[model samples]
Target: MLGVKKIGWSVLLSLFVLVACSANEKEQSVSQNDGGLQVTFTTPKKVEAGKKTEYTVHVSRNGNPVADAEVIVHLEMADMDHGLNGFRGKMTESGVYKGQAVLPMGGDWIAYVKVKRGSEKVTKRFEFKAEGGMMSPEELEKSGLHENGSLKNPDF
Candidate 1:
């Protein structure tokens, strides 16, 4: 029937709209390296807590891609008052450095990007809110904190 077909199309359109809206909810942030190497980077639009999130860093100096540079990412949930061990990045064939970082919890976090070339280093920081699963006990234990949930290194 014509009415049935119209209803079917309406349902399909609603589903499409929901999918599109969901896709837009993921948060992404970009930062420019401030110290030296003249690099910029993008973290995933959305990253699940307790899972590995891909980090893509484009390194360049004077408009040319910098090669053989070491990229390190130090992630910390400043709101949660803890820091990750940091992730080491690898250079891709396209001259972009890639790294995977696992954020332990969902909250306010800061990403410190450090790019090292020989003895020179460049650094940048990005702040963003993460949306996803809660941190497990195992993950919290591994964080730099005592079993009582106190910071192991308070001086930091």
Candidate 2:
């Protein structure tokens, strides 16, 4: 009976750890207008301190890619009271926009992504955490980016 109880506890602990790890791997997304417009995007999984990192955003409306819209992001550390860096995103191709900015330190950050289409626009916010330091070339390669902060493949 003692061994059976121990196995149950171990299984519970393992499940807890699996849940925590998978939470971090999930993509964060923000939606507005009851899914009328949205942004499905990817930023650098992590960033290095004082180093510039690229954020890739893909904008869509009614399940279709929005190509002519302008993308911008305003980022700030959520855990601290301080000014933040904000930049505009440029459309690369296929409704994908990319922007590069440097995060000052390692902490939790929030990004307000704005997508402007014609005379109308929508804003969605996403939060992500990162550590300090630049990523190595190999790490960048695995991240679907090149040394110049551009996606290595057009399909990326």
Best by lDDT: 1
Residue 106 shift from truth in candidate 2, angstroms:
0.6
Stretches of model 1 off by over 4 angstroms after superposition: 1-27, 33-36, 138-156
lDDT (tens digit, per residue) of candidate 2 on 1-156: 125774465346445544554567644444444466678656664444356678888877777878878787877766543344656888889788898766554456788888888887787778766554333456556655455333444321
Instruction: Pick out the ten consecutive residues of candidate 2 with the lowest summed lDDT.
Output: 147-156
Index of the highest-TM-score prediction: 1
Model 1 scores a C-alpha lDDT of 0.63
* TM-score of each model, paired residue for residue: 0.66, 0.62
* lDDT string, candidate 1, 1-156, tens digits: 125774465346445544554677754657474545776667676665566678787888767788898888777766444434456778985448887656654555677888888998878887765554345566756754443233444422
At residue 65, what lDDT does model 2 achieve?
78
